[model samples]
Every structure is written in C-alpha cells, then in structure tokens.
Target: MPPLPAIEQPAAVFVARPGTAGRLGQAVSWRQLMVWPRWVTLAGFAIVVGAVWAVVLGVIAGAVLGVFCIVVSTGTALIRRGLTARRIMRGSLTVATPGMGMASRFGSGALDIAQANGITRLFYDRVRGIHVDRDIVVLRYAQLFIGFPRELFPDWAIELIRAHRAASGTTGYSANIPALPPIPPIEQPDVSMVADPGTAVAMARESFRVTLRSVAILSAIFAVLCLFLGRLLSHDHGLAAGLGLAVITTVWLLASAVRGGPKTRAAYQLSMPPGEPLSARFGSEAFEVRTASARIRHPYAAMTSMRAHGPAMVVRSGGIHVYPRELFPENAITHAGMVNKLLAK
Candidate 1:
C-alpha cells in the first residue's frame, strides 16, 4: 500500500492580548447591527416615538418631537461607542492551534470564559462566513461572532485557518479568489493631520449613514416579505397586515432621515484634542492618509466614492476619509477638482 500524506496542523498558536486602543467592540457592534431583526427593532422604536408625539401634540409638534428623538438616539450611540471600547479593552483573548480554536474572557473571567477553563474552541466548521476589512477580521457563526485584530495573527496562520475552513466545506465571504498584492505606501503629503476624537466621530457618522441606508433597504424588503407571508395565510387578514407593515415602514424611513441628520451634526461637535487635519498625498496609482496614529494607503480602485461636500471632500472606501476645506484654504477648490477628476476616471 502507498504511504498516505500526513495531515497538516496549524503553523502557530499563542495567547493574544487585546490592544488597549483596539476598537474590537465597534467591530462587533457593526456586525450585530447588520442583522435584519436589529434594524426592525430600531425602526420600530422610531415609529412608536413618532406615533406618540403625533397623538399627544399636533402634527407640527410631532415632527419636532421626532427630531428630538433622533438627537437623543445619536447621543446615545456616541456614548455606546465609548462604553464598548472600554469593555473590549478590559477583556482578554487567546488563540491556539492543534486543539483549541479562539477563546476570549471578559471582566475578571480571566482565561476561562466559557467555563471550559475559559476557552472556547471555534471550529472552522462552525464559522458561517468570514469578512476582512482593513485591520479587523470577523468570523461569523450563526447569531454569534468573533472579531479580532488581524495584526494578532500572522499571514500564514490566517491561511491555515482558512484551509481548515475550506476543508470543512464552510463558505467564506471571499473564497477561491486570488489575493491582491499588498498596497504600497505612498509618499508623504504636503499637509497632515492627527486623527482625534472628532475625526473618529466624523468617520463614524459616515459609516452610520451608509449602514442606515442599507438597513432601510433591508427593512423595505422585510416589509414586502411580511406582506407576502400575511397573504399566504389569509386573504382578508393579509391585506390588513400588509397595510400595517407599509405604515410601519413609512414611519421608520421618516424617523431614520430625521435621526441621521442630527447625528451627523452631533458627530462633528464631538470633543477631541485639537491637532493637524488628515494629510493626503495622491499618487498616480493610489493615495495615502497620514495621522499620528496610523498611515493608510489605498489604490484608486479601492475608493468607492469621492465627492466634494461644500468645503470638505469626502472619500469613502472601507471607511470614511474626510479632507476638510479649512485644511487647504488656499487650494480647497483646486484640490477638490483634482480629486473629482480622479474619481471620474
């Protein structure tokens, strides 16, 4: 009989402590918010608030109250971000090979989170999907998730994990695709800015907008589904149910717009240390953003959109990149023109 090939094991395994500055909670929150049920809940709340105000006050007053609800919601969101960051920073994480998968401990739970000595084995077979965005890697499993900083795991280790996932027949967000070459760092820009709390808030607002739009679309689809299910059960009741869903969806959409406007303005007012604005150096093939914390480079193809908004230029790809007009007072228009030209191409 011919000798069988030996089964390959994971290349490396070690305990990985979460970074103090890591936004693990934010990453997790993003994934959680992506669920349709969560969107429905949020929209439902908005609709209820709008309904109460409409009844108690007049139509105009109800409109005002709706606006107030949105402001409060935005403030709550900002506070949640801070709390999430703190909680994640206080947690401990360990990743291993051969046997154990990835485990995390929150609070004083130390190394034993799940009571299996605080270790949880996330077998590749359990992974429903995988999503990679910049510095974070998200492993989606049913309703639960495990998000970790990519820097904690070596490239080879990631590949090994993927190999196991493939062998287990679990599908990935991106599978069987050739990996793109590493983005080369571009030259330093003439102007630079340190990303502060305000900057983070601005980026968050943009992200929130994008997410809200997606949720809105999904909510609309869900309304249709509800209508379909209602009709499938009973013709008379189904008509009433469909109408109810339509009303709920309409209210949700209105509230979302009202809430989003105030949120964006609130984000701009977020407190942060005064520092230089983000600097950008545009290359023939790519652009780079430099700040005190990180330097990021992205090819033009990676940019999803670039548009001049009043005095500021907003560039969104994996995240929001803002170039405020104040940073380039002398050449704001010229710079925006150049960027618009590139985006058009």
Candidate 2:
C-alpha cells in the first residue's frame, strides 16, 4: 500500500477555452456578478460619489445619484458579459509551469499562461479564490483567474491545485510579462464564426425587448422623480430643474433605444456561426460546453432564470445565454434537475 504523489511528476498539458471558463467561474451566480473585494470597492466609490453630490442636492437626492451610478455600472457590466467572454475566449491559450515548481510548490505553485494579449506567471498564493465548477477548476487571483479542465488535470493534480489555492493571498497584478521560468508557448488557430441567422434574429428580438423594458422603467421612474422635485423646490427653481431633468431623461431613453438598434443585432449575428457538434457533459456541479471553436463550462447553479423565446432558450446566469432550443439535445444531457428546471421555467 502507498500514498499518492502531489500530482503527476511534471506538467499536464491541456488545450482549453480558459478565458470564458475563467470569466464564468468568477461569478457564483448572476446576482453575485461581483466578488466581495469588488463589492467593497464599489461601496467605497458610492460613498465618495454620494458625499460629493450630497453637498449639491441635499442628502437624499445626492445619495440617489450615487446609487444611480452604481446601478448604471452594474447594468453595463451585465450587458457586456457575453461580449467580453466572446472576445477574450478567442485565439489560442498558452500555459506552462516548471515541473519541479509544480510538484514542490503543490501547496503554493505557479502558472505561466498566455492569451491573445500576452503572457503572465500567476502565483497560487496570490489567488483570491478557487472555484471547482464541475469538471473545471478556476483559480481567481484578483483580476486574474485561469480555469483548468478536469479532463486534463488528474485527481492528484487537482488536489495539488486545491492545496496551493488554499494558501492564496493577493499582491496586485500577477506577473504579466512571463520573463520568469516556465514561459508559455504561443499558437493561434485562425477561426471565424457568424451565428445562425435564425438564432441571431431571435436573440436580437429578445435582447431588444429587454433593453426597451429596462429603459421604459427607468424613464417612468425619472419622470416621477422629476415631478416630485418640481413640487419640492420653489417656483422658478422647480420649473428650471424639471425642464433640465426631463431633457436628461429623454436623452437617456434615446441613447438606450439606439443601443438595441441594428448594431446590437449585428453583434449577435456575428459571434456565432454553424457551430460544430456541441458537447454538454452534465454533472452534479455544472455542465461543459464544447464546440469546434471553444470548449467551456457553466455551473448549473448559476442559472438565475430560464425562459423560452421562440425557438431559442434564453438563460440568464452570469449573463444572458441565448441558445437555439434544438441545440440542447443535439449533443448530450445527463442531469435531470437541470432538465426539470429548464422545463419548469
């Protein structure tokens, strides 16, 4: 009888779509799009912004403005989720770690990785958190996190990572230039995708509806607030403020209308093409999304809401994933709960 080694002596190489998985794993759920550290930063920003506005528009009004900024920022982040993931997930992934360092420092190892932008050596101790999302492991260190597919990393490898991750700390940006040991190799697969026209149109319509509804709600709230302010202030001041607020609100509405315009549709139509066979390996924790261009995973628990949109399946998780309904069964599905949930929703 013998005990297992930390991990296979040297390195275990893998071809991965780490960018999307890393981004996806950073979020536990759509509601928790921001990590605690980020939320703290946001809070600090709100306080500072609120304090500045408080002087101009009294306490309550000033506080409202600060909150509005926070909302806008969060909304922007949400809206950009799909775009960010798609952009970064493109191109090839480069990764390498010293065999000795990986084994010896299993409790505090490091990874040198490169993407479309550049290369970086991420120290395990600097990682903010480690999330084991089903078949993938994501080590999030501040603004950096790389997801390793479980298929590539064996049991001991994962344990090593877990051990190293458990001892993580922060030191700002992890080595960005990879002049260090275990420099990553670079290779790119020239590939392009244009989503299915039908799916694109459906997603576009759904996206437009969402934007329009959000803008409408915001417009209504703005009108009511402006009217209230008109009565709250003196005659001339109230009239002036009302006109200004009305103008501002109107401009915002117009801008939002344009956002859901043809440009948005074009983006949707651009991101996906006749995707090859998609593989969704369902398990207790999450599910894997495999295609010719990319292979990523999503935590089933992250699905905030699921609904039907024509022939599409609109899933609101870390972001809105609009899938053609027929695509679900094209590959594989193993989880009953997810199936049940999707069906129920």
Candidate 3:
C-alpha cells in the first residue's frame, strides 16, 4: 500500500444524515415526526390569530406583539443562516441539506409533517482532533457539538434547521467541494486472522433466502385474503376486485424490491471473504465506498469521529459522512466484529 496524503488545516465540521457506510459500516437511526412543537407553534399561531380574537386594547396589542415576535424570530433565523453559509464558503465545514447526508444525520427513519419544521445544523471544530477538510453541512444534529452548550435536537427540528440552512444556502453548500480523503492505514490489534469467504457467502445467502421466503409467504397470504374475501360478495364488483388485487400485487412487488436491495447486494458479494471481516472496494468511476471493516481498505482520511449508530456506522470525512446501513445486510455486526478482530492483528 502507498502512503496516504496528509490532511490540511483549518477545516470546518458539521453533522449530516449518514449517506454511506461509516466506521465499521454502521449507521445511526433518527426519526422525524411532523407534529413536533416547532411546527405546532407555527400552526397554532395561525389558528390563534383567526379564531380567538378580542377587542380590548391589551388583547389586540398582545396579539400584534406576538405576531411581531414570530416574524422577528424567523427573520433572525434567516440572518443566522446567512452567517452559516459564509462559514461554508470560507471552507469551514461541509453542510448537507435535505436529501443529502448520512441516513441518521437528521431524520433517520421517518420524516412526517412536524419534523419538517425543526431540523438544524451542528458544528464541530474538529472530529477526533482531525481537522475537517471542507464546508459540508449535515441534515442532522450538525450543531450538537458546538456553541457554549451541546444541544441534542429532535429529528423534526433537525429537518427544519436543514430547511433554514438551504433557504439561506448555508446548508448543503461545500467550499471547493473538498476532495475525498485518502484511506487511513489499518491499525491491527493482537488477534488471530482468517478470512472465510465461504462462510460469509453462506450467511448472506441464507439471509436472503429467509427474506425471500417471508416476502413470498406474506404476498400469498395477502393475495388470498384479497381474492377470497371479495369472492364472498355476490355483487358484480369483479372488475373492482381484480383491479384491487392488481394494485396490491404492484405495491407488494415494489416494497419487496426495495426491501431486497441490500440483501441482493450482500448475496452478490458473498463470494468475497466473509466470516473474518473483509475489505473490498465498490463503486463506479463516480465515487468510492467507506467503512470501518478491517478486511476493507478504509483509506479515506476521516475528519470527524467514528459514531457507531446502532446497526449503522458513521464516518464524517470532509463535506460528507458515510452510512453503511443502507447498503449492507443486518448481519453486518458479525462481519464488523470479524473485521475488527483481524485489524487488531
């Protein structure tokens, strides 16, 4: 292996949803809801203004003052947005906006109405003492490590922060779009080393087979219920029945396809070393995969720290962080442990 490039100084750091696999290929999970307080406040402001009205001088004056306060607050937020953008342009850190980031960067699993109102950016001066290389912003908790106090934000509010950053152009903006960091050399711990490609393949295959079986069973059960329940009726709604079944089948197929993507990828790559943790490269000419798997070459110089997000792993490098959960199977833990053990060698 060749020597990796040295990192430069004065990098900015921000949090984002996990976009790819990070350290150990784990991803974080953050849920976002629509009815969170921030959005509720906005909605309530509207309702209160319309339904509850009073003619007393204090009541009218109070309402006017409240409205003014809301507007001023929103305006101030926009101003902060501009300042944040300036930080990005200056190559302080990378900011990921909506649709951009690690999976758990902000709204991990769900993003409903309330979550859309409160997401914000988190800033970090350094991740694990490594200077961030770009001005990348993340959709989730990018602002948690910074300021006088570290604040943990809910997913919904995080989404709103993203919106504010995007509208201000400070979010999702990367300065000079920092180049990908060089992969770091693996630090091996003392441990026995072995690569069991066959074992890995078998595991992946078995997992996929189980998933397929379950999906098939569910499909059949649902299909029969749809057909049989409708058959009991004597009405001439046969056409509607047929159409409904078709729709159900279509939906099931789509869901199954999406649900199977990771499994399929794992199965296809099963031939590679499995049980001992494997290092492999994936991607076309466009980009490369990042992970903490010891068998894999994690040559990328990660500016941020490694956060083990449940089944997912996160590595913040430059303007973006990678999440491994979206691509790998749930058996990642076994693989990760194996990789870590090997790297220990």
- Across residues 283-334, which tens digit of lDDT does each residue of candidate 3 receive? 2111133222212223222233333444334443323333333343334433
**Residue lDDT tens for model 1, 1-345:** 111111123222334343422556667656654666654676566567556545544455445545544554555566755664544433322112123333222111001112111222243444556767676667775335566655544564455456656766423423543332212222445565564555555554554555567767866775675566446545655545445656666666667666656544443433122453456565554555543323444455555567655545567654455555333433533444465565653
C-alpha positional error of residue 151 in candidate 2 after TM-score superposition, expressed in Å: 22
Q: TM-score, each model? A: 0.38, 0.40, 0.27
Worst 10 residues of 2 by lDDT: 96-105
**What are the lDDT figures for the candidates, one per model?**
0.48, 0.48, 0.33
What are the per-residue Cα lDDT tens digits for candidate 2 across 64-124?
Answer: 7567657855776676654554433321121212121121112234654322122334555
Which 10-residue span in candidate 1 carries the lowest summed lDDT? 107-116
Better of 1 and 3 by TM-score: 1
Per-candidate clash tally: 5, 4, 71
Better of 1 and 2 by TM-score: 2
Q: What is the lDDT of candidate 2?
A: 0.48
Worst 10 residues of 3 by lDDT: 23-32
lDDT of 3: 0.33
